[model samples]
Target: MTLAASRQSIPDDIWAKMQGRSWHSDRGCLPRKNLVFVTLPYLNFSGATVEGHLIVHLDVADDVMIIFTEIHQSGKFRIEKMSLVDDYDGDDDKSMFDNNTSAYNCRLTRGGATMSSHGRGIAIDINPVQNPWVKGSETAPANGVNYNTPDKRDAAFRRGAHGIVMPDDVVVASFARKGWKWGGVFTTRKDYQHFSEDGM
Candidate 1:
């Protein structure tokens, strides 16, 4: 679906709050099962897009509202949920070349070298258990394989049927249509739930 359509899925009140603040007119949107996500526009070293996206899940909309209210009460503005996994990698003092995956292995590593997108707060991995990073070395297990081993994940990567339950894919497609790239499409590793403004 187009970005505009995704944007329309955003709750009116949430949209109003996001407008002119955390989100700008240039940002794009994606609609998922009971959620509307707004993606930021930024690029990564792998030519992947990275940006902040507001994820509002219908089931957790109330929780989001509470978080926003709490932030506002504390005099904070433009609040966005920064994943803890992202924070840990940013604070590490080890050699910058370490192949650290942080929370999601969205980062690329060559030998001992490491790369990350969480430092910019542009990419997000949602409900990681449902969407896992299957390594090339091991045969994918059945329980965690949502549709079929790699087929389901592959379909999701291509923006097909298997992506329906993944809110991130919707966000990815929204970004892709706008010239952004999803981490799932990367040649080195497939980050099934990663969506960024840069082309990975």
Candidate 2:
């Protein structure tokens, strides 16, 4: 069923918590008028399901999950770990990446000069440990160096180490089905952890 068709609304407190970021400003980011929340099922890497929310622009609410049907049909809907952006406490990208946390932080682009799709709730960063950002010789979490390769591994480095998410991985495929762009395809820097509405 569609978000509007279901007539569901995210709870007040949960919605508040999701937007509790210090970078929420009246800048170029999408205004509150264009944002909405929808619940999405989060699956751990092990295939267990958990409750999660997907913040998105109001215009795309109905179409956002078109890919979910294909994923479910293919038995690939398992999210492999999902959480709200408010779960993390700081703006430190490296720290959050190290912990393999997924959130919707409202911060500027990596350079902090302009608003990021994340700041507008149009983008999401998944398992950072498995999908760490890469620029030149630097990786978001130093430990994620091993995942920089195009090889996607289902299991983490050690027992709990983050797994590798490759371009053709189920996660990327699901997001792609929804018309979102993966940063791993970037030519210069690879933000393997990111997916955005417009590939921003």
Candidate 3:
């Protein structure tokens, strides 16, 4: 089925939930009209089919659907959950803790002034618990640091662990084919849960 069948402008009710949480008109975010809600079909670790959602820039919405469709067909990987940032009220921490894969949150990098790729809806975070964001001694999702270890990381590629994304995995490959960059390759800090247009 063509995924284009599902993308749409944000409804007023949905926008209300995202107002202060994920989108702020006062901030330098793109206009809501430039964003689209797209459906992503994927598989669970057990190979069960699941439908997901994302709010992304219109330019990348189709790309996101294509990438997820590729990964879903491969059946070589899985995601814990996939939804918009507003699902958790734009709480990145709670989303990570709950392992919610998502895109489009009009926030900055590490809550700083620098806009994140996510702010532009050009980035997506998947399975944050299994693939945490790491910087120095810090790791996101509170309990995911151990996955940074070689042994644990190997489990991801080997499919010994669900929701963990490996560099060579279909999840990464699908996005890569669309010119997105995986955050797992970051030199200073590895953010295995991240994938974006610019690789940041």
Candidate 4:
């Protein structure tokens, strides 16, 4: 039950992985200097503890650590898998399909060429397969479509679903305590896996 998170400057090896992927030299993305690498402990559905290496904006690094530490303390939540988006070569689709829970990417938010909180390293997505992005009839990961239907959302009070986020769950509460917005509340699209500083 002893979970931990250590935040530090991006190591040379990880920085190399992010180059041209989540970290871009030009086009004015968030600077590498403003990001911090965090090593965190999270549990998988089977109750196995996994160490997650993540990068997020320095502004949220401490908050992110505390939030996740609370989640680990609860021990009821689970994340199937997590990794840097850079490992997926910056292809968000691939990353989502793999259910790679992560934060930060060098990409614009949908609908325009604007940097999202994620692009600025201020957002995180968790358990994409269980908490998929839903818009109309389609889900981002396709696998998630079966997990988070509107009916299931109403059943959130039950809290039986494994990786799906619920209002009463530690995941939501932990993020909420930090004043971060849950994308699950979005009217346009339901991004259940998302938590961000700006609600984007």
lDDT of candidates 1 onward, in order: 0.37, 0.60, 0.84, 0.85
TM-score, cand. 4 vs. native: 0.93
- Measured with C-alpha atoms, the lDDT of residue 80 in candidate 3 is 71
The candidate scoring highest on lDDT is 4
Error of 4 at 54 (Å): 1.1
Please, what are the lDDT tens digits per residue for candidate 3 over residues 4-71?
22678988888888988899878888898899988777877676787888898999888887888888
Q: Please write out the lDDT profile of model 1 over residues 1-200, one tens digit for every residue.
A: 11111222555665455444433344332223345444323222233333333443444334333332332233212212222232333332221112121222223332234444432234444333334445564312223356323566557546533222243433443444545455556676655544444453
Give candidate 3 regions above 4 Å deviation: 1-5, 156-159
Q: Considering only N, C-alpha and C atoms within 3 Å, which residue pairs clash in candidate 4? A: none
Better-scoring candidate (lDDT), 2 or 3: 3
User: For model 3, where is the 10-residue window of minimal lDDT?
Assistant: 1-10
Candidate 2 structure quality by residue, lDDT tens digits, 96-199: 45444343456778865876777666676766766778898888776667776654333443334434556576767878777889888888899877788889
Tell how far residue 5 is off in model 4, in angstroms: 0.7
RMSD of 4: 1.9
Write one digit per residue (lDDT tens) for candidate 4, span 1-200.
55578999999999998888888888688777899999888888788887897899999999999998888778888887778999899888899999889998878886577887789888999988878888888888987766667686557526666677876779999999999999888998889999998878
- TM-score for each prediction? 0.36, 0.75, 0.92, 0.93
Model 3 TM-score, all chains together = 0.92
User: Candidate 1 or 4, higher TM-score?
Assistant: 4
